[model samples]
Target chain A: MAKQAPGVRIDGLTVVYKTPAGELPAVRDVTLTLEPGTITGIVGESGSGKSTMALSLLNAVQPPGRIAAGSVEIDGLGDVVGLRGEELRKARGKHIGYVFQAAQNSLNPLKTVGKQLLDLGRSHGVDDLRGLVREAKELLGRMGLDGARVLDSHQHELSGGMRQRVGIMLALVLNAHLVVLDEPTTALDMITQANILKIVREVHAERGLTTLVITHDIGVVAEVADRLAVMYGGRLVEQGPTRHVLGAPRHPYTRGLIRAIPRLVGDIAEAQALPGRPPTLATVPKEGCVFRERCPLRMDVCDTVDPEAHADGARAVACHAVTVKEHA
Target chain B: MVVIARRLAGHLARGVVMILVVATISFFIVRSIPGDPIAAHTQKLIEQGMAPEAAEQATRVLYGFQATGSLWEQYGDYVAGLLTFDLGQSVTHAGAPVTEVLGEAAKWTVLPVLAGTLLSFLVGIILGVYAAVKRSGKLGDVLAVSGSLLHGVPQYVLGLLLSAIFATLIPILPGDGPVDILYEPGFNAGYIGSLAEHAVLPVATYTLAAYGGWVLAMKSSVVTVLGDDFILAAELRGMKRSIVFRYIARNAILPLFTILALSLGLLLGGAVFIERIFNYPGLGLLLIESITMRDYALMGGAFLLITVSIIVANILADLFYSVIDPRVRSGEEVSA
Candidate 1:
């Protein structure tokens, strides 16, 4: 019953939040695509709008925030941005499974995991609830948990790692071909994070799913993602095959991000923290490249004109210096 | 199972201690009030043309206590009576037991106050959820403002205002008493109808006065729950709007249950003024009459009942909360 994994295309997607100063875009007009059956990761600093961009895929940006412009096209589901009400709701779980940022707090504290699982099945109009339960148990067991005991326990009874696993189980139990995991390991310890990432990769390949992992940690993306997309201040700075992007980043912002990760073996001073704070909604410049204030390769053109994403075969980078270098 | 039983036992023990303390304090407090009931009654009998000695004897026989008795002796008698579940006689009621008098009055207060509180809770919770969901809208503002306004209005004021409108202005419903004296007291429609008619004003007063508090409490609770990660996650899961709403309500309502139980206990005591304003013979009214007549036994009995109810309500709240919220159950078990 495994469906062929669906590719996702996010084109010119813009999400804005209403502020005292008026609507400010959290996600700017940018385009990216997920190849069928590939795991893609988008990494960014806090307030860089990576989470907002991910939410736009589900068209689930909360109020005080809205999708200003965009079309998110999945192979089976048409433009998600245009879907409304019951249609939009029905599409969420059955088609796109989302593991929320804090998997630890995502399950209802008042209910047993089994009860919540039944509730999920009932909400989706599942006729075979028993089958759904069996499937959920299998998924849980696959993740190295005692499925029966975990299902009967309340969320409080589960450790942080266990809760994160439960979150993953819930997402995959419905057999969604496209899954989004948002900071799935944020609160977990290093060992548990690695364990979860390993499970994620195994499950994605085993189920033939196209997955999107959203995080701020480069190490996370480097570990599991087939492709890496780096975001800074609401724009996709660079994206390509994970190894190539990490090995030789084209965008200066991506380079700084990679350099900021402290290494275990290297001289400690060699790892540098990026200078300046990330821009919040109010701080992002309106008419220039969003990263120019902190960009090491800032050109005159970066002050007034936004650089459009320039795509080469299987790779994209949005930076004036990169564009100039490529043309030269 | 063992944990739950232990917890229950713990709550019961604490409640018993609480009741005993309140009982002892109220017993002393009632005794310390000036003007002895025995002396007052004997003086009244003498004024009614009986001999002074005979009047004193009659007062002593009727009250079952000497005016000059030691405070410790009376306290011992009171404690002994309490141990046997005998609340002794009402000094003002001639031959009626304090328990019987309280029971009669309780029949009037408990149901109406309970009905009003629960009805208000239902109304408030529903409105509160609506308000929180539409927090930024005009309807939410209106409900919130009105709830605050009504909550601030004391029950007696509400009772008086309702009486003025329904009784004095329109004169449709009976203004006071549990039932009309003209009707034969039976299981018939007329008697039941009059009883309900007399109860309307007090119940309305209780509902209106307490309604705002529940609305405000529930609104804030729902608002907090709405912001929880699980709520957003549930919505993302494509749970139907109704299902999502159920999740929100179930979680939000958990905090309000303890408040609801305590309010149930407190509202009985608050019924004093409202009952007085409407002249409905509930425990509050009975308490007032007992105090005015210097009926120490009846006053102590009434106070004890109120204290007992409060303690019982708290215990029930703890147990009920544990039942609904597994987190609380485990914490309680650990503590127990």
Candidate 2:
């Protein structure tokens, strides 16, 4: 434990939801590392366990839910699996910071923004509330609102962008080392989304905060992520440095994702969409490649063997065809 | 301020129209009943008469019997009398003014209604918030189930049960009448405490009976609101559980506000049966009295007062709508 690296690390993390149909694994043996002072982008569509992964950090998943098997270890904090009562709360509040996707949510409408900020700041022992207010004012001012107005303002008074900025402020104010941002810009307009992402980048750099940004947009990953993890069917298909994974992709799923992105500068007609929708977790293929139904180069062996992570340079992919082709 | 004023004015206009229609309908409906007040009064005068002409003249003046006018003329005069706030003297009560009787009874009737409605609103909200926060667990499920169970039971049954237990068995509370505290009151705490003591059973009966409805409303609202994305967002902010509960409860509970306002308006109307069962001397009880005694003037005044009180309460609610809610402004802005 002492020798472990600083930041969030999950080894073989899995989550299963017990439904009327049966047990459905939402996250399947997903293992990755989010280093301190760096931003990691996780790209997946809805129901990709991107959210399940995020909630796993706080152990805040709803009932009929189970982590099943895995270890989620934060750098300074130990395993989050068994902690309960005040111990769990202290760890979640002090160590982990979470940012929800929507702006209209996350702040109390009944409370003033100043009070929300103050509550977080005071709880975490940032005794200098005046200084904190000054800092909050400065942050909101950068996002284009009168600093004084933001203090007295309720959430409804602000625009979507402003509300999201306040959300960012609420998460970052305590300077919690790890901030989990779940689709932070999805609900915003293009202009507002760009502004928010810009602010996120600026804040990350200025404070050296470690961020795990969950997004479905490959274009967003191309912009802000240092490394990328692509999840399909509740399992991570590929993860590596952003450039290598995007440019010299190995996994068939990863390859499909890049090819699917609409090309603005080149022939858009040449772009391809992923062959089929992501597989249902309830009835995932038992003894074969998860992507076999969609994979263009699937062999008979693909249906018989479960693929393991095969490394080619810094990139790791989970497909038998890719591994055999590269090895040959 | 302008919005509130405009809203109140609109409600007041509606209230005035409702009052006129209700008053007119009630007047005709009571009048259309079997016996005429004139004939009834004259019959008694005739029974005790010294001479037939004297009896006829006596009944005529008592009833404003105008042999020279048509029914329309009489109705016009009645409208005029109503406009001048003259409800006319009670035919049965012999010289007691209609307005004076109602004014005295209105306070007694409104007290129980006010107590019941407020208790229901407050208790329902608290319980609803509790049920929502605890949703998905045994506690939340239990609260929700129990609230539904109690809500499904008739209000009268609950009221009677309470009356039976406290009024009949223990005899700790005076179940039927308002205490004349000023006369028989002891100063252990003062007349106020004794008055409160006397009012306890009625308030409790009303409170217990009404609480279930509020609980169900609040619970459902909270559950639905909790499902919204905002609640998850707030939780992620690392806001304390208490703050989260408060914010979620207040915002999610907005629909309940209008329901509460409507309930407050219907309060006087609802109390009639309850007051009758308890023999409480409220407007509802008096209403029953006036109707049974065939006293048209008193009954008309009572009905008008209850209708006006309801309208006024709703108007007050409309005025207060924006005060408790910030989203109201944004909603108004969008609609405007």
Candidate 3:
């Protein structure tokens, strides 16, 4: 048996948010492993809790949103769920660098980029004053931006594309073991998106940094991800190698998502639009599969019982309708 | 530095325009009323045993107010006097210079307002930030509720109560005037002590009245800033809470800065009700005197000074804003 490489291991993770109405579970019983130097993409619709799962790496979930149960472990960093106060803060950017969804707001509008970057480096106790400044400038330069100019100018002084690139640079500056990007290219133009993806691939190859890309658009993630995990209704429905999973999505939900993307050459009318909206945590069925209400393959048995994942090699899918043969 | 300079210059030009506008409006408003400064003075002269024609001629020459000319001609004389640093004579003061009257009153108003404003900012900002960043427990609730509740109480009501408690009930501080007459008005320690003792109630009255807005404003703004992504980013960089607070609090205090500056301008106009309550000799008392006697030159001078102070304060706020906030400093860069 082959052991998984040293990277992030999120096990039995459950996140519940305390809303005015009641306690609602956002991400439920999710487990996944991101191996070293590999790009793992978590694809889902907006409410699927993919971002919640990603932000849990830093304990960065905002107020009213909290991790109810689970532990997140990085190679040598130990349990993230137990760390608190200064210990938790030190472990954050040092262990995992997060590039947030909003590129424009990622940098503080008040301070120059140079001051922010230097402060970040110095906070980590980097004593090479002159050298660090040089590296900081070069880091932005590597992103094909005017490093010197950006260092002096405020955040709003830059174009949107340039700001997102600078955001990516901020994450890499810390050189964390796992770089978690939550919808990094979502707000960017198509050209900037492609440029950012290329930079991500280049940085990954050069630094051997394990990366997690969480996005709703599967087509974008498919370009650079080595593996894929599909989330629906707060649960991980399917995960395997990126190409294989995209080619043959075993779960009905994953198949529907892939079919929903419009092809330039394909007939527009034939696009398979998923009928129902994603279920809220409160409306999730207690007696059957969470996706049963929307699943085209739902049967009488599916309505009465919950389905569990059946694993073959690294591939796992939580669909009762699909029969699995034991790997030889 | 250049940015601040440019912003200051621009505001100064606008401030000049603002002063001119204020002067024009106040000039016409004072005249629109029925009373005439020259006529009143001539009556005083005639009662002093001067012939009627001679009294009228002397009054006209002394005040430089021509009775036979159009209102515009009188305005031109006023402007000409102002250009030469002559604000005309006080009608009731037996020819005392209007500038001298306003100048004496201005010092008294400036002293209390300056001390009061500084005290409010220091106390309010500290309490507000501490309240926000505290454990978010019962103490925070107490701080928040009590602050706003105190703010709802009017300044004069608080001033009266405080005066009753400290000035009359206990007699710890003087109730009336800026300084005690027995002190002989010297720069010695005893004289200074007497002055401070008299100022205590007025300063307290002003601080108690003004600090509430700052506390409430700082609390809300700091809370909002704490939730900002920049703070999160700082924390993720593994910086201490104290460091994050330094940056976060600076941005949070911006909204409160403008409010404080404006209130300072109002107070300098002589927190009239507060001044009268404490019996503090300030511009408010002077203003009241001018209004009652209809001493046109004196009233005009005092009002003009108040308007200039307010305009200057606002201009300073505009300049200071650009200095503190990068978004305003680099206006050309924003929204690019």
DockQ of all models, two decimals each: 0.75, 0.44, 0.51
Alpha carbon lDDT of residue B316, candidate 3? 77
DockQ of 1: 0.75
Scored by lDDT, the top model is 1
TM-score, A chain, model 1: 0.98
- The TM-score values for the models, in the order shown, are 0.96, 0.87, 0.92
Which wins on lDDT, candidate 2 or candidate 3? 3
Q: How do the residues A5-28 of candidate 3 rate in per-residue lDDT, one tens digit apiece?
A: 348889989899887778788888
What is candidate 1's lDDT per residue for A164-249, written digit by digit as tens?
88888888888888999999889889899999999999999999999999999889999999999998889888999999999999
Residue A179 in candidate 3, Cα distance off native in Å = 0.4
At residue B22, what lDDT does model 1 achieve? 89
Ranking by DockQ: 1, 3, 2
lDDT of 2 by residue, B148-179 (tens): 88877776787687778887898777677666
Candidate 1 per-residue lDDT, tens place, B250-290, comes to: 99999999999998988778889988888989999999999
Worst 10 residues of 1 chain A by lDDT: A100-109
Q: Candidate 1 or 2, higher lDDT?
A: 1
The list of candidate 1 runs beyond 4 A from truth reads B42-68, B332-336
